[model samples]
Target: MCAASAFVGYSYYENQLLADTTTHLLEHYNSNYVIQNLQGTVVNTWVSWNLIQGQTLHVSIVNDANLPEDKITAIKDAILSNGTITVDDSLLHEGPQGTSSTRYKGWEGALANLQSLPTKFYIPQSFAISEGSNGAGDVVITLTNDENPDGLSGYTKSISDGNQILKSKITIYQSSQLSAMQLGAITRHEFGHALGLAHSTDPSDLMHATIRTDYPYISGCDIDAIKGLYSGDERSQVMCQ
Candidate 1:
């Protein structure tokens, strides 16, 4: 009887050790990421962009709820055409960093293969809006019929896995508060977040957290932000991550 009791005690001890190890591992994994803001001092947040292999990023939309198909198409188009913006001539000048602060205006190379956004049939409804990547190197957008609190237009949640952006989810709420054109513009703004662009201090930019109805299209600041992100320069002011 004593020997059987001893074996049971040993088994229990082993299980405890395993549980401790697992807990430690989880703590380490969760501690791997951090979030920061760009030049803006506003309450808005941004994530570092993850540049995938071949410098190509794929976009997918979650349409499981059978939301309006036309709206989905509108969002997809907005993403592909996001890099287009007219720069302000007054802001064009070479910065002290050897690269012009406005150099991102000419960054069409990043979107050379820009294509229409596609629809995906499945995506998890529940997810942790965390700091690192969600294990997918692409952007996923979801449309909801629910109302957004605080009279906000839309929001983007990005995940990073260490230094790279693992995944980003953009949520757009459907409401009568916004016309179809305004909704499309909001999608473009969220897509900027998925691309690792932060909220711009300038309200005229689409990357601004609260998009202006008058400046619906992407702006020079938005273009510069993306260009700086993929510019391969370590000192660019528009930083990711």
Candidate 2:
């Protein structure tokens, strides 16, 4: 039942799943990101952008929480650093009610959890989690409620807060049994929220309106957006406000 919310910590455990890991000096790149192979099988990823200052991210996962807590911080770091995160684990199974306890069915409870987290960053206003048929599937979480159903607790970070407020909670399917596809998509999408991102219209992007496992990591636009948010802020400036 325990869900581990991983950020940078996951990179230390499981094998790096990101197909693109090319990161180098962005000043010399012609594209938003440059992908290079370190070896025959390994790739190095990098993005060219800066984020607003004073963004402190927090990661937390409890039982049935959809993420493993031990990897929460690593997860946050990866999201902030644009998918440079990983974790190490034997892949242990948590009980129905392990250390992870963050759970909810609908909007009220889930939103409350996000608002209550201890951090300066905050989530943006978003549509509540509801049930409906989206053209992509029975439920697609499009920008509008009737358009699509995200199927998981939706999230968006606040630029005003440097996208650090992750007090938002997550919601799992009530069926008590979910497929790996659903879990991966949901985790990726919600974590996107934690990183201050929104759904991209492009299907190739993980933030696509439809909840699918097309890309399990952040994209170039996502990296530029995050860095833009974090780049301008000076450490001392945040303290005054």
Candidate 3:
């Protein structure tokens, strides 16, 4: 890790996959994202070798009342469409962060910035709760506090149990560095990797390498790629996945 001003680092473990599937952590912007995929096949231990493992993906979503529930779910569904996504209830409402929460400041900053953008980052709460719970690890969030030091904004990553449960020990950020558009889009994209999908060079898809303009939209091709892996008999493989 660099100094507090520029914190970033990258380490890799050998072959490690849950049920032999890949997990990508969005390559993370400024290297603050966590790629949770590496775990011991034995269930409790994390894959001490590779960068991806652990089938259990625990992520806490973040946002303010300004963001609609439906929009968040849409993003959640997009991620669930590939694999499991979970959000800890502890971080969902105001219960976890409490009043003097550090997440409050960044949440306000992030929300204010998102509101300024003309994008409709809204999703149905029902969809968010249901789709996320539809077997994929998904979580609807509000208090933002995962300790990802990438300036937050719009970063996504595939987290392993160790990084989440051991290293950061945080499933979500306490500071509000992620934008509404980012919160939804990055989770969907990163989760895609969790399901074994890799980064695509296509900027028109959510699985694109970077968050290019309009890249948040899950393109038909990207969707097809995901479906192909689980349902269509095609193997899923992409860079970093």
Q: How much does each candidate deviate from the true structure in C-alpha RMSD?
A: 19.5, 19.2, 19.1
- Per-residue CA lDDT of candidate 1, range 1-241, in tens? 9999999999999999977854432222110112333322223233355443334555566553455656555555565432444444334331233332221211122244232322121111111121223333366666566655644456766665543456666666543333455556776666666666666655444555555434456554565565555553332233222
Q: Clashing residue pairs in candidate 1, if any?
A: 48-240, 48-241, 131-160, 132-159, 132-160, 133-159, 133-160, 133-161, 133-166
For model 1, the local distance difference test gives 0.47
Clashes of 3: 45
Q: What are the per-residue Cα lDDT tens digits for candidate 3 across 1-241?
A: 2564343221212234321221232223321233454563222222111213223334444443334666555445444443322333244242354332221111112222222223221211122233222223343333344444554423333334632322111123422334454555665555444444556654434566565433354444454454444343334443212
Model 2, residue 152: distance off in Å is 4.8
Best by lDDT: 1
TM-score of each: 0.54, 0.35, 0.37
Candidate 2 clashes: the total is 68
How many angstroms is residue 99 displaced in model 1 relative to the true structure, after the best TM-score fit? 23
lDDT of each: 0.47, 0.32, 0.37
